[model samples]
Target: MEKTPLEDWIAYKIGIRPGSLSREAIEQYQLARIRQTVALAKEKSTFYREKLSGVNPIKIMDYVQFSKLPFTYPQDIKENPLRFVCVSPKDIDRIVTLQSSGTTGEPKRLFFTKEDQELTIDFFNHGMRNLVGPSDRVLILLPWQLPGSVGDLLRIGLKRLKACPLPYGIVQDPEAAIAAAVESGANAIVGIPTQVLGMARHRKGKELAGRIKSVLLSTDYVPQAICQVLKEQWGCKVFNHYGMTEMGLGGGVQCSDLLAYHLREADLYFEIVDPETGQLLPEGELGEIVFTTLTRQGMPLIRYRTGDVSRFIPENCPCGTILRSMEVVKQRISGKTILAETDFLITELDEVLFSINGILDYQSTLALTGGKDCLTIEVKTERKNKIDPVAMRQVLHTIPAIQQGLERGTLEVIVGESCEFMPISKGTAKRMILDTREQQQRPSGIQHS
Candidate 1:
């Protein structure tokens, strides 16, 4: 019955955040909480009990000792999910689950207690408070699949925001969804970028552009071009959010892409490390992002290696928010290409190309012959036939590094599927970079300790 660390931090004297303190104070407090967490999990949770049979958490002051316990991956829970439960079903308040599926294999299981769900709502509400005010109405456009948590809690938070939420899990036709949002008299829209982009390009949303206030792009990777087109046609601000069911609604934005995300740090500790070494990488190093939840009663990921690769900003947000800043990752590490000579981080390529407004949507794949790698780039455009090949190539091929790599045949750009892109997978849709490295590496991996 001990109070959760997250609840304590949020309900602290300021009733704002533990992050309001100076950097030195926050780290000192964090280390103390880490000690408390390790002790609590080890004492109450059998999984962590076996994990720390001998080592003392006090001795392992930082992440090094924390990670040494074992790499707690999704598969460990999937194989023995019931064993992961620290409490019985009678004590459990709520349960949330997701597929623990691996690549071309059986899906794994995920669970959440009521505490976990509320924390998720808190962050989602905190994130939404940025876009909405008292007068707005929201239309949530989600896949509405079995693990309905994504749209579920978002609806709850929107309700808490004093906004009307019309949750639509069915969008069999993207074009029709566009028309519905226009006619629903809703002021705001939230859905995947792919489906929303299809609507934005359609003539209907363009016709009803003046009525909307903000368009939220969620549950997928958003191409900048789609954001631009939506902003232009819909005449509303297009906002991007990064979150997952396991982590709760984790991240939100700061008006401009240049400003890194205002991370919900008190709930989760954000660490960007050398992807290979697991050593804490310095700020600005594009490293793998691993997380530890300070207070998740259901399924606390202690040093859980989230398969995404991103970097951390060494300072607080410029918008006067005390929450830490993280560059919501542009590329996942699994998408990188390691040829016989050079390794290409596709995220850097995305930064260069997505900044240009000419292209609408793109998918990058790595083709390997022995050790050589050629990139197959597919682009979706509204005006594909009208595009200037020479002028377009000059703009695309002129980028100093990408062009050099293209000349060496290590990089190739080819466009495919010029119209709207259908959903590829259940979770967030990556740019579809086919890295034929091991066929095992994904944005999130299923490694068991």
Candidate 2:
């Protein structure tokens, strides 16, 4: 009899469940798996074979040749999409494309075979088991849902869990979502940080408090203070999960520590390399995380570059999962949001606030003020007593990019809750520096106090 997909995945990968191999054994398994994937890509896919014409997968034993093969940027996929399609159109079972919130231009298209879908279901099923039990009712409170992507996959996983599914998204306004949660008797909430908290504006669902047992925050980083309020008000645990459309949604959680995510090793091999140099870095060192997917067939990625900057911690998780953890730190949280010849890097701004001594917690949104060139920053602080904008401006003025944007009357600073910072979303929040700026540029952008 053929082994079920779930059975095969558990047996194939190590450290995910019982009978799994150790990291050393998983490495050996990966070598064979990588070779198989490369051959499949070269034989069937023209895009990779042409780029990898003279390249041998085994000969790519080091990082230099590996990166030299070709970096698969989102634009490349958008331009000549068929380049990345590994199988025939008929062979494709489902197509999951995304308009990237990437700092750069255009969105990319991604595909999954019937097999790839099965594998994703298996991986998320195993991963979710760690975060939730059978008695949970999950409220997917993300504000936006891109058609034919993550929300559907999550629904598949939820079905397998036999947990009640509470559909929540941009379709439901914050007030509507709060009413849904109250009506559905949902025990756990899952989604972006903004939408979950957005519901707090309604102020009537405080009675739904004890029903929410846990909050699964994804697609962003959860600030520390936001998590505190979630636990205090909801009387539940906040589990932060980080995933990317490129990475097949296989990643770890930061429930035990502050905001952190770990790469799922059983199904893929994780490496940290110096972003500029591509040289592998040791643990506890910050670098660009690169991934090589093992079991994916419809669309397999080798040495894929995820732009996130993170460093790994060496100890075991206190949650007892034995999974290694990675934390985002000291990197550019924002991107080139250049308006009027001046570009403000998100990284510099985040480092400025995060490095401060007195700040307990914070959330920030970026906006373009007055005109195409004008920029405004809206920041919210949890500290009640001591918050100063002038001091913050002095620190910002030193940076040439920010100062020019300011001197031109293009930059404005406002302090208070974000117009979108509602209480209806989940725990962990995704606050890339560009998101704030992009939201501000909208015609009906944030409304201030």
Candidate 3:
């Protein structure tokens, strides 16, 4: 099997031959870059200057010492994003403002220089080679209308790699999107997980499915069930990409091995830490993902907490690359919620619900009604009367937390189906378990208890 292209790219960026790329060489380079980043952040960024007031960059020699620095949170950026800017206003090329869920206050703003964005494009160029090559047409189902949007950057990167990028924004009409894909003879697709799954299961999906050779799912967690469906139906290679807007929109991607993500180690340093205690965890131990930007010039973040839950793979990849591999993130620390003396995650629902045939997508809402915690699931199906609520309830009962809540008599489960397909709008946020117990009105949906 071919190794990850990122190994060669990282070696080139670090001024070493690809054959000489070793873990030791990468760590040495990362140490130097970390020191440089700390010094620069202290000298240029107002937020880092105060945050690292007592620390001397020269004295920080190893990763252990660097881990002592205070972590930067999303709240810190939302409080005053301008303070994190390491470059002058004129030098900054793009400013991405993100409104986090349940936040009514100021949104987090991330500044990026042209150079910073170019690094992302370069990463995308190499990362995409794992799925596509020259002249391969890829349908981009991400926001591309904006200048610095991920789709736009991906289009530029594909151009650099001599691939054709079909810039179709997020899926608003699955049929139309599928038609476009077929008309353009798209060889591959890059899209949100659920949206792509919906399209593949759509009525007109089979027309394009047989033609699509590969797919790259990003922006949200890629459910294994979704990958299975895509692979089974389309007979295509399914790749999961791990990234966020804060990581300059390009972090890591899966290689041909399809086991885990090959990290963008050339520009960022990643660490897994215990979520509650904030202590570093050993390799292969699941923890919150924390990252520090080593090459970012506009906003050099130091050990920013990602709130994502994943672990670094301890063993070498079967693809023969030495680049660090992280397991595909399946949960977030913030996604866990407690109700009726039990806790559950949206991911748990994803695993069970998406596996059932005919189910395209679903929304899970937990609300308190009549002194009981109610979990309502509104499902979208391929056809009317295709889903059996009894079977659905049986499948849902497989979840230990749900079973615990139900056996305690403090919770109830309601399942309903809607054949109407709802194509996700452009820039739609990730789907989460909505807790609406405090609200007076329940969500408008077909509910059956």
The model with the greatest TM-score is 3
Please, what are the lDDT tens digits per residue for candidate 1 over residues 1-449? 21112222443622344545555555555666667776777877788788767868788776556656555665676667666666567656555555432334344455677777787777666567667766577888875344437777777777776878878764556567766776777788887765676566654556558877788777524556667777887788877766665566564444433356666666776777777777888777888777777767666666777767678777655455444677756666655556435555655555545544445446666654434445566655555564455555666565555567677865555544465553444444345456654543344353212
Rank the candidate models, highest lDDT first. 3, 1, 2
Q: Model 3 clash pairs?
A: none
Angstrom error at residue 318, model 1: 2.8
Ranking of candidates on TM-score, top first: 3, 1, 2
Indicate whether candidate 2 or candidate 3 has the larger TM-score.
3
Structural RMSD, model 2: 7.8
The Cα RMSD of model 3 versus the native structure comes to 3.4
In angstroms, give how far residue 7 of model 1 lies from its true place.
13
Steric clash pairs (candidate 1): 100-107, 100-108, 101-107, 101-108
